[model samples]
Target: MHFEQANRATGRLVTTGEVGASGASDSELTTGRFDGQDGHGGEDGHGGKGGQGGQGGQDGRGDQPWFELWNVQQGLWLQHQLGESRADSNLPLWQHLHETLDLAAFRKAVSFLVDRHQALRLSFQDTADGPRQRVLPVHDLDVPLVDLTGLADPEAEVDRLIRIESATPFDDLGSPPVRVKIYRLASDHHCVFVNVHHIIADGTSMGILLRELLLCHRAFAAGEEPPLAPLPKTFEAFVQDRQQWLSGTQSKSMETYWLDQLAAPLPRLRIGDYEAPADDVVNETLEFWVEADITEGLGALAKELHVTLHILLLSAFVVALRDISSDDDIVVCVPFFGRDTKDLDGMVGNFVNPLSVRMKMSGSDAFDDVVRRARSASIGSYANSRYPFTRLLEQVDAEARPGRNPVFSSAFQFTRFLPPAKQTSQLDLCLYGRPDGERIKLRFNYNSRRLAESEIREVQSCFQAVLRRILGDAAISLDSLSEPLRQARRTMRAAPRDGRRLGRLRGSRSTTPDA
Candidate 1:
């Protein structure tokens, strides 16, 4: 699970950290009492140093390493999606084929994914204590699988297992790219436990893993070894290419714009009433999804307005926040997939970072005007989007609000375009439940993982209202989104929805009432 770092100049292994107790089960070596005060320091026992830590490994070609090219702290972390199964699910497809989890095939798949992606094979080396990147050959990422059939209620059991499995973070330069623990609940029921160094994988990579898992599984089951296509290029290539393309002048301009944006005293827009904390785990999440139709509408509007869908979404969100808080100046974190590199598609590593979308809204600004502003902000951020949100925070040394998010209220993200839901061969999967009655804080974090179908529809309702108010009355200001924004505001902060499950939506009305 751990390896000593190899001396770059000597090309010999240099050991560090207490060599873990020999043959220690990942559980045993990783087990420890963390009071939350100790933080994750103990877990990262010198195994995988992400871009933020060590000097990333370089290539023999004297080229820039892929790890260095991507934003530091961006290429670390993975996303997983858990959904309900339906009787009408695609179980037949799975049943038509053998559904066995073969280790050899899995290893081949892992090796292929790692070799194809530069981020996975990237490592750091040293010269006179100055460490840099050393890209390693792609090899099969070996992860010992523990069969936890003895444990009942696998979900609950797996949660405990994740805590233990993730206790020891990847700290050393390069040993195992990813650690996976497979929990098989039944012949047809199983869960994949994956622990990726936040430096190499992000939410997008998770989608890639699931898709390839099924694709590889099918090919293996069919008794045919699929000949994998070679990667168009690697992350290392990307670094060299991007740097060349954005030489001195272009880089300076981008850097200057970003610096000026950060020059302002960052707005601390409070979303909730919580006593600031000395230091807290602070898993502030904002979960909501736009409806399929509304998403289409936004896409259409973006096309018409000559902006990206993300820009439109960000604009509406800013308008909503400004209206609710009655603050003209606001900021929110927007997570971007920082690929900016060609030939990075299908790479199974973290390549995401947060960007600050600072909106300077005016009371008199029209909704369309706000849209234009939001679009402009996104484009500008992209031009000067080299630094990670973490780096920006570090630069400012911004004091985090005691119990709240440091910079702004929370984060906003959309994930509908990820791999579609898959059908299984075994049990019928139909979700029937309601959210628990808990007062979620407003300093919310939004991503694709948490929202339900009904909730997605509700969000659509609000967006529709906002869009109607905007387009219907061109003179209306971005403040017009306030009414529809209130619907979601009410649902999230108001009393819980009657906790209904799988109920048909009652209204089929257009957003315009007087139409």
Candidate 2:
């Protein structure tokens, strides 16, 4: 099988392959003399030339504008324990890379994906009739993987590379119908990464791209040109489809839901006791992990309750708010994969939709009943999630509430992505010396003004305790979740808050924590 990767340091395509089965161990190949600027003529049989530029459409009208989906998570960014390295070199994982190496086949697959999904290859056009979408055609995207080997300090080099990428900024403003980046990292091995701004592809589409790229690379490795499937419809078709849907009754219902949710303006969190300059805003992150067993227990509880994992998590979040904010009503931000269609899976684009989940924590509401409410609200939001969050914010005339973010504050995410399978032959594949840091995969930004690490942890601990209780007693209602939070408040009264700055809240009393 053959695999094609973009070499960032040297903007060139590098191809590598091996004669092996579906799952073979990767053995390192000896490096010959590094003479040629273009990585070619290697004994391991890895080399490729850049393809011709794709023909842009006639009359500037043919090329579509660029678009991006932004999930602005609010609150204090969750910080991690830095500089603590663990030695876990997860190597020798292999996938069908032979087919994904061919440039032609890769482009064909990308086009197929974009043509079938609106979230991929969508552009916003400023026309006389206001901003509109001018969907562009998907062209060949050649990602060159560089081998950043023998660096004095590879981590420094990687950080330098990331800074350079950030400088160019993804051009979310105008032009460059797509934001493309060639990233370099040394995770258990030196490797190059690519993040095709969702304006061009989504997470699921990435899966499609990888699968097709493998097929294409395999065919190329075997010295045979493979024919790829044609796309059924262009992104424009999706735009047209969405417009029709928006003008219908569904749009009205979505607008109504959003308006009602925000009727009570969001409350701003009071930052930590420390005072800041007039124009400065304080930002902080607190990160903690829930072990594998805990995750499994949560999943099991969800299964037993016949509710989605999302609902269970949401209920926990509500309980947290009750403990920390002393508020009965709470709103948490939830991100949804906007690609509801099966055919859009392989398309690369941004389709993240944010939904505001508002729930009322009543004295008598049972835990099971709260889960049911959150679940129903979440599923219903998905049905009309196509409404861009920016649009919804504007329609509701809601001002950005003070705090970390203008709109939403809290976020929830669950990831299950395994690393890319590696080839057995070292000559065909290379592993980095260090492991990849997976802690920052999903981040939450919170306001230190109102909530501190202590408060957040106390709330989280309460939720954990409540979840454990529910695991033992499935019939226990939502009111029962309060015991832990109540216990937390009692403990806090005796223990000093960690970062008690000058102007911070000495403490606030809410409904007494009841058993």
Candidate 3:
């Protein structure tokens, strides 16, 4: 989800700290507990060591081997170096988990995870040339156990700490790229706050870390060896492979393909219905859902049209965008999974890449026609998806405008990977939909500076209408679908004209595009 423009001339590190009401620096609260107070020594076990910046050589000062960073990682590092290290930046992952847990066993589980995953132990540095990373060699963790059992509002205090820590930027990227805080609310109630920078972990890595940690914790609690598979291939190995691929002819072909896919003057997404200073982006997410039967109809429509459910959802999004922006040519970046081979199955890092899925639409286009275009575009982009988005921005020569991302204004993805939504530098709106049981969970993460809460709600209403109208008829005119929905928003809270099921989908027919 990280976005940035590359090729900056110079960068400077920005170290930030928060002065709490108690006058203790938040950084002190952050690192003070882990300075070997709990049996382990002060050198926290993040496994970081000094290395040649991006040179991939062992440091003479007695550190470890360095790996040349990927293009997206370098972009994120440069942004961080130049002071884009805000809570709204699309680089930090924050989550809180509650369960009955023993502190010692939890600490042991985290320590085991840190040892097993080299990515969790990574550290970065900004050099004159650029930023690079190296893996630390340690295998243990010193977790700060914050006891809030007797506080007047223990739950509220845990929430406060999470907010403060989530806002607390990682000043020194050269330290451990991960932070873990355990808040004890009661003997049986606990909260686990985990924040990891996107440099070493993506959405997928979050699941891997938690799953492995819980597995290890259960085994330790039972005095049994953890039943975990050996990670034969480490993150460093994947880095080498990626660097090799980025240098070869395949990369050249991919660059060529993307450069052609995203031609000049990429269209802007102005559907947010307002314009403000682009620099002042804040994250606001509005969530809604489509009825279960209509969700089934969407699946049925995709099946009838011979396209994946993702493409179908994307086509619906395109219809909505064309209506609002009035742009015949729309580009929506679709983030793709880049762990191509099974060798990378065990390795986790920043491997997700954005595929620029450009669709050409007209008011006269049918739902089937839009889906065809979307499907083709998704296929084309996925084929060349490994070309880093930052590098693609370079070749695409997108305007490095003050407010928005250099490439696409909006992004859409069908994924189960749900994080707290926020607006970033590159997106005006990020529309995500995933299947939840029989229903579709839709979340619209928007930049509040560019969009109003009412505007976002209108979008949700219109999108719901689109989903329903499409089921009743895929060949329904775009204008028919749009005008009715737009009016639906202005009038009142939308209810199904034909009841809760919306328009009941008829039996499947030939939605295939005309040859």
Each candidate's TM vs. the true structure? 0.58, 0.62, 0.78
Steric clashes per prediction:
37, 68, 2
Ranking by lDDT: 3, 1, 2
Locate the minimum summed-lDDT window of 10 residues in model 1.
7-16
Give all candidate RMSDs, comma-separated: 16.4, 15.1, 13.6
lDDT of 2 by residue, 252-358 (tens): 77678777767756643332342322223333444445555656776788877676554676676666565555556666665445554433334444444565667
In candidate 1, which residue ranges exceed 4 Å CA deviation? 1-70, 74-98, 112-118, 122-133, 136-140, 145-174, 184-190, 213-225, 239-247, 273-275, 284-309, 386-409, 417-443, 446-474, 478-515
- Model with the higher lDDT, candidate 2 or 3: 3
Name the regions of candidate 2 deviating beyond 4 angstroms: 1-168, 171-192, 225-228, 265-300, 397-399, 402-407, 415-451, 474-483, 489-515
lDDT of 1 by residue, 327-387 (tens): 5777766544555433345555444545666888765688778777765565555545544
For candidate 3, the per-residue lDDT at 260 reads: 82
Q: Number of the top candidate by TM-score?
A: 3
Give lDDT tens digits, candidate 3, residues 198-296.
Answer: 667665566566667667877888877688655535677656656666777868987998888788877766555334576777768988887788888
Score each candidate by Cα lDDT.
0.44, 0.42, 0.63
Candidates 1 and 3, the one with greater lDDT: 3
Q: Which 10 consecutive residues of model 3 have the lowest summed lDDT?
A: 7-16
lDDT, candidate 1, at 504: 24
User: Which candidate gets the maximum lDDT versus the true structure?
Assistant: 3
